[model samples]
Target: MLAAGGLGTPAQAAPTVTPAAVASHQSPSAPQDLAPTPPMGFNNWNSTHCRAEFNESMVKGVADVFVERGLKDAGYEYVNLDDCWALPQRDENGKLVPDPKRFPNGIKAVADYVHSKGLKFGIYTSAGTKTCSDIGFPGALGHEYSDARQFADWGVDYLKYDNCNNQGVDAKKRYTTMRDALKATGRPMVYSICEWGENKPWTWAGGLGHLWRTTGDISDNWNSMSSIMKANLELAPYAHPGGWNDPDMLEVGNGGMTDTEYRTHFSMWSVMAAPLLIGVDLRTAPESAFDILTNREVIAVDQDPLGKQGEVVSSEGGRWVVSKEMADGSRAVALFNEGSRAQRIETTAKAVGLPQARGYTMRDLWKHSDTNTAGTIAATVPAHGTLLVRVHADRNWAQYPPALDVRAQDTVTQAGHIAPVTSEVTDLGGNAARSVSAVLTGPEGWRITPKSATSVRALQPGGTLATDWHVEVPTGTAAGDHVVQLTAKQRTRSGTWLTSTVPVTVRVGVPLPPGESALSDAEPLGSANGWGPIERDRSVGEAGSGDGRPITIGGDRFAKGLGVHAASSVEYYLGGACTTVTAQVGVDDETVDKGSVTFEIWADGTRAAATGTLTQTDPARAVSADVSGADVVRLVVTDAGDGIDYDHADWADLRVTCG
Candidate 1:
């Protein structure tokens, strides 16, 4: 249950049951009754990071703006002071004190000023020995209870706990310690965990805190803000009432972000159900910032009682379509354009599992108007802008049946032709190569080549076979499916041949909207050969002339000149605990490979732990392995290889999963 704060006088604490107690008792198991929606607030981190010159006057100034501009009435209740608020040293009792220069009136005075404006107050601290502000304030450390009491005494309504300078200890324990301590304080304060992806707090922090930072710190620039927003879309499934996945603080209203970017930022956050912690200097924000922040339709999504964050359903170029399930069974859709040019983003109600109902209510979140019709919604979003629309069934609407197309591509080829089998063609494991002969027939002028053919022993009656022939399909092929035929021939007794045929189909790849790549382009860690040169397409590399160390790609190279193979092969490592070896390979620019490519690490050249595969079916992908075990260790990349250019690889992301 949401804990209660403050003490009632003896006269008010009589045996009479209050309305709040009666309502609470009526709902015994509702999660919303316990946690409800997240508290809306404004934080000072993104725009002003511990400006040493800031004082209580500055705090009061920002608070005054919140009140005068109706931000507090709009549900922004907390004025959070982030980092560098404490003195350089704690008192002998291990209690942190506000900095005398910046907070001369003490924390209580600042809290009082905020309270007078009908807003709550928040403070920041670290789970480690030192805060990010570099101040030597006492942390939760071994004094979780003491620190909790101190914060309570200071009337802090919320606490932002940072995870910096605190390592070697289990991260969750550190967070839980503070949570328990705060619970014991008899003072209800919101807990915000600031652990940046170390242990994805979004998956488990719901029981321990009010919110958790899901991404790294956001800057005031559009690139950083948009990138962080894009990453947070994948984490939407975890956001809910009482707990939220924070994408740092808002960069909107900050001077650096463009007006269009600011609108997109606000629209995206609302769709994601992310906390609306405005980080701008409110006292000086332009009118546009206020309009973007206070859009009722957009704010409705963020403040939706259902509290479901939006997820990216489809994205191309700079256009992205995201959807969030609302409490009323309606879906909140956000069409975002992050490109330099305006583009039309469209989505059918069926695509989002919605009823194709005519005359449905489509309220524009930013414009605060209802759209006329809604079977299929399309909007020309401005560059770096967004359109948020809440789709709901109206009594005057007509519903239609849903239509969906489901099909999978069945053919694979290289350089626009059926590649022949060759003696050098091997599986991803570097095992013995496999050889086969195939014949392909299609429209006139179409070309066919063998990729792994061992020998040209026989051919069909009317087919032409060439070892050096490679087909090149023109760019921008028409959208739709096209078919061709492939016939395989095997040499038999008396110079005769056996032939078999298979059908192949090709579909034109869709281009991204403007500034984005398809999902097929995302690369994960620990992929084999993820760090090789762009020209070498082969999976495993050939051992160098000397020393013959196993070729490694992803991890930090210890023995400077060691070379990883171009084909695929497992490598063993031996050395210091800090030393590591990695292997990675890139996929072709087109085509996505399915299934995980697992890497097993062996200590002393023996099995240590069986790690799961780094799975991907995305185009332009890379995976790697990190070897840091003691003595000797072996790293293996599993699964069969696919696609062309496994020979002439490209440079991609190379990072160690674990070290």
Candidate 2:
């Protein structure tokens, strides 16, 4: 039976797409010309999949938002539906039919409306007998040619062919059949193979589709995002112009993660050269989400003419450096922090494959500003965040202002306490900078006072300047990551003013009392779990707070500790007052002898202690780490080379000693 539904929003209603309207549009270009660069657009699966609200009006409104919100101008051309847009069964003529309730005027009418907005329209179907949705919409398995012809008649410009209920068919054969069918239509629709990387589509899909999913579906969380990143990072060579390694869709503007994490998500996608498909409802997205989604500099990297995906240059202890060569001879570098605490991540321009020069221009993609670096590229990147920069050999050092390599260290402060913040600037240019000055500014209601001379008469080439400020956080200010802006300015010979700005993340936390105490009793200064909230005195449960059973590891029960999923981190600001941290760590008994994990404790970006692989069959291992004089303590768990399934880990009886 066909289910019916109305459009979700009542915004500017579009008329039914008529046959004449379809006739008015011309056929698209050849398949090779489909996506010269990775496609940038919207897909509804991640946000509103199979929901009653995902109707014709909702899609039409998306097309409107694309145009009204400057998304089309920003290079997002397709408005794509994911699943459940059609009837459970095809029509008697063997044509896939859009649900009458969902698309009252039929799919062609909606495609026409989308085309009217100067945007391409895309529909979804599976290679198997049924779609992935619960309703089991009819798929284009044996009826590929008929369905493709139906799609062409309706003026569809893109097809998202999915993988579900494959019925033992060979992945390559199934996808290739659809490709042949679509090609036979001569409508020039872009094909997106949604095989979820199970068959290593990147190895073969390039010749058949514009893009292919390199990973499974992505969730709106740090773990899901980073894990997918890890999977796709090594496949850079498989991506090229007209074909991409799709890492699912963009989860930006979704409320699951913080703004900083969302920025990292978008930045990494751009660096990977993946499709930039909006996966959230644009009508109600927050301005902050829009800020991340509409970052032109980041988008430019994803759409770079070179079409080269970034590859990991180095990854150790949760710090990752990825680099991609741009068509303009520049390289996009991403300093990623997969850890829980903010730490200084450093890399050299040469390390990222840039040719040696007098100085390199390091353009901060997020800051939209240029800075000079002799060779060292470094910044204190926040946890689960990314510092994306474009570095290239300086062509005209004199034409630009002296490169100011400015950065600040991560600071941990308490409410109403004055903390010393330092900013270091080096002149990486061949020319001197006159009237050099620096300033530090804090958030509103916080006071920042200069502690050292903020100005120097002149900064010669290769000279370095260190400035200091005392930042006082207001009492009662919420604890967490706070921004402290460091700005450096200088005057060029042409009387032009140049300035470089970097943000220092200040964490405000309560000091631990003198004596041993259970870590679960105190709120984490920062945390990112693979599943849900960091559990207190319980096993890591399914995706909610206080949902776990008692904390138990390998038949050993504990009363005090933190339970977390694998690939998790719980950080605390120790303020150099903690002496040691001890814990009994192992895969939780809740997994019933089915999981494996490794636990590590980090102090100020250095691993203090680590446990060998502990599976559900092994007893909890006692581990202790010296945290004396360390500003922060981080507890981390990793899925031991296996998948994260049943990887519920426990830091049983975890305790920290302070003062």
Candidate 3:
């Protein structure tokens, strides 16, 4: 139901009712009468310009026509005068005044005129330095408060705050600033924030304003209307009462769109819970335009107070079907054929979350009629046309049997003494390969190698493999689990070799020993060295300084290229004598593995204290490890023996804390 205009405060009491009170009072559960549903109104900007050159005769002429055409009686109450109705400048006290030439009798007289006709008056302004029409005083930045108060004084019921030149500042803050200012005026003016959805205003603007523009400026054309509707459908979840998602103003009654397209536009907007601000020349609209605009069934969904916007469930070609869950446990569906040829669209209740149902009532909003149906329903929609239906099931409905569901399979993992490896190759071939030789087109260090020949190939639980390759896990390679891949070349008849590979998971036993340590205490100087100084290739032997002993690890020793090289340790002698220990190390790119590293420790030089290793089968990755123990500890960079480059390794601050 729509609201009638009145000046009573929100908290004011109704006139005393005698023993015969036939009218229903406001519900106690629903406080603060919401602005009203189905905002039926006509806006001037789209059809006629209200410039300074136009006079009072023009304004009265439009108002008289609105009443004569039964628009006001049909519930289109607000005769909103958009931009350019106001002068280009403010008065001495910086207050906006209506254009004297356009509004000769003053804004107060115009307001009285509109009120006498039992209609509300709406005005437009900018949230920026200039209005879109390039007229009227700017009300953005610091002038929101002053302009809001002035608008309230002029008896304005609604404010359309446009985003013109108001850039740089955060949009939320700017819109909220004006909202708070408007609230302070002791007037309940509906705040419309026009930001064009930059940063998705619907996500946050609901709490700040009554409505927000969800798309770019809409033109009076079918293409513009359809594009705006499509964008709004994707953002339907944000519409609700006290706030709405605006797809610009109404263009149905305008001449640019055909009758078929206009029907689709109205149905789509209703399902989207978009504002129905009529932007046509209402006084001179044809009968068909009125019929399209006054479709009762479509308006029911738009005015459903539940305020939920419908969403598109599927689309084939240009024919699309959208559904919205109504507050009454019913579903509102729209079948739209946007293509050049008519199409038949069908939807089952089960597909729309409604299972088997009996005695279903389908209401055709445009035809203002209801049809009974059972189970699935189909309709033939003309090109650029729509068929909107609201479906309700009887209480004795049953659910349908479920359909078969398919699940994805998992890949197997390999086992061995080889180091655990994980690789992530970007911008490589579209597929993954197992053989080092297959991916070794550029260099040898780019592939993964197993510790031995006995390792069996096992696929990962997930992920598609790029190639097929051989697997070999050698005995006594290592004492722990390892992952390896082999690439094999399949020669074509033309002698062109293509590579295929598979990953092999191997589990072994002998874990390698931790590396040796040489340097001493490595500490930051000057208040914990918040930003330490450790120049490349530099070394220091001090317990408290940020610099530590610099040890260089060589890569030319290991068969795969290089293995773990340097380590640092602190000793706790008998009789409670504790000396601080620290170390720093550098790598010549060849000494470190780009993939993984491990850290370990040995107490009193023999018994193992802690142990761990890291491996990267892919050369373009890095991993870190932390090791700590009582007497001694070691850090190892495994897969270091693998033919990979570790050119980016710098270890610092290896220390021991004693109890």
Candidate 4:
């Protein structure tokens, strides 16, 4: 009944944990077949929490969506519920009670409905005396046996045991009590320990739980998501089959971050082999959200039978390259950019532990295309984006033309304005490509003409071809995100043809007022800060807007400015009417002489002004960039060789003049 295995019991007393003890810990003996892959499901905490909408109908609708929307087939099997599902107090019989108001038909009926849909049902409870919500529902700290038996009777296949109001009890003992209780019921249930990594549960909970939260609760923002990812990325060594290091639930469809940032969130989590728990409401979710959640290729990497967590191959200046070894001898690689602008991150097949071969076949998980490479694996990853690919050595890859790396700049311009979209094509394979040609096309009624040569007779291996296109937006085009396409084609020596298509995103903006104004006074076409909002006339705070003090750099205070963190960008539409942009840029003094950053201003994608490696001790430096005939201007900040820790940067006295 207990899967025909024995689990050792925890010690009666909680032992103090030391770093040496964590390092010397042995592998967990948890059931290997319970979750051979990370569990995929929908957790209704981020989008619903304890709201009235989180009721029986909503829970059943989730099960329906998973079946109708292809999620169930994509390997999402569990429909989980987070806190506040039960009555605030226990019954006189010393048993927990489900909130009758929320579950009018009772939790057992809901579990039966979910099971009828061919999906497993999961429930949540804390290891303490009370749950995490303010309503304070009863927990299973001392009632593990009773609660476990009750859950088994209700047909709960997964149990997410949380840590709240733990009452100073030992973390290991608290979780082990519940694990042993579940075993006693003779019903197999996946155990998730939600201790928030306060006691480093990954060191001890592997054998006690199927997955453990490695960071604090995740919020729906880039700062929160990226920081949690960084924390969990370092604990890959502790994860294996039947156990995993969870960064937190997936926030892919939450409104706090852009779709690009959400993609990064999902990409990094997949590479890390973290659980794919959808944290948004599926009933009213947009198609874009579904597009991201159901990316089967990315999901495949997460569900690889090998169960090897991705490890960082290289990280420098906010650019990270991570690789996961797959069971089929392929490596899933992710090129992630945490910077403000586009950057090229590089790694090699050998670097990812692949055997030497004549060529390697690469499959882009996002683009859904295949390319051949000699060894180099590189991409100019966009800000807050990840390029996910699968690479494996192929002896016959030479029969195909090396995958041409075709890409274009993501342009931001005003309606009726002419913008330049530069593109590049490179042959990354060992074989030469013949009859190489490229073309750029825009939406209907938009004129797209090439300004450079678009064809070549022969392209040697490793050679690059650059092309420029002039994109003229019509006067009445809508002011929203638009798409442009760049297509490249080539032929192998065997007469086989190959084509690569790349999509470039263009954002149309409204022109600013024709006068001198504080840069922060106008809305930016795009803004991406490493942490928190881009503050107006204040230093970059850790959270909400207006939370920062006056913009200060080297003890100098400024009343009119913009505050940002390193790896930040703020872009504004100029309508080709602005003359010059000026600002005093330096590291913010809030960091107490501990942070370093670089500041730059770009006019129409060209660097017009820059500051060299400014530390907190450096005085504010003046920077001015000419914007003659430029349609857009961008203020940028990046980490200075060192990491981005505490890198609060400021653009003091920032002013833009137009007309």
lDDT winner between candidates 1 and 4 = 4
Clashing pairs counted in every model: 54, 0, 49, 0
Model 3: CA > 4 A from native: 1-38, 49-70, 134-137, 395-659
Superposed Cα deviation of residue 648, candidate 1 (Å): 18
RMSD of each: 19.8, 8.3, 23.1, 7.6
Q: Which candidate is the best by TM-score?
A: 2
Residue-level lDDT of model 3, residues 277-331, one tens digit each, is 7777655778888787766667778878787778778886566878888889888
RMSD of 3: 23.1
Ranking by TM-score: 2, 4, 1, 3
Which candidate's lDDT is highest?
4
Model 3 clash tally?
49
lDDT by candidate, in order shown: 0.58, 0.83, 0.53, 0.85
Which residue runs does candidate 4 get wrong by more than 4 Å? 1-23, 255-260, 407-422, 441-452, 468-485, 491-527, 539-558, 565-659
Instruction: Indicate whether candidate 3 or candidate 4 has the larger TM-score.
Output: 4
lDDT (tens digit, per residue) of candidate 2 on 14-116 = 1133455434322322365789898888988778878888999899999999999889988899998889888887778777878899899998899999999
Better of 1 and 2 by TM-score: 2
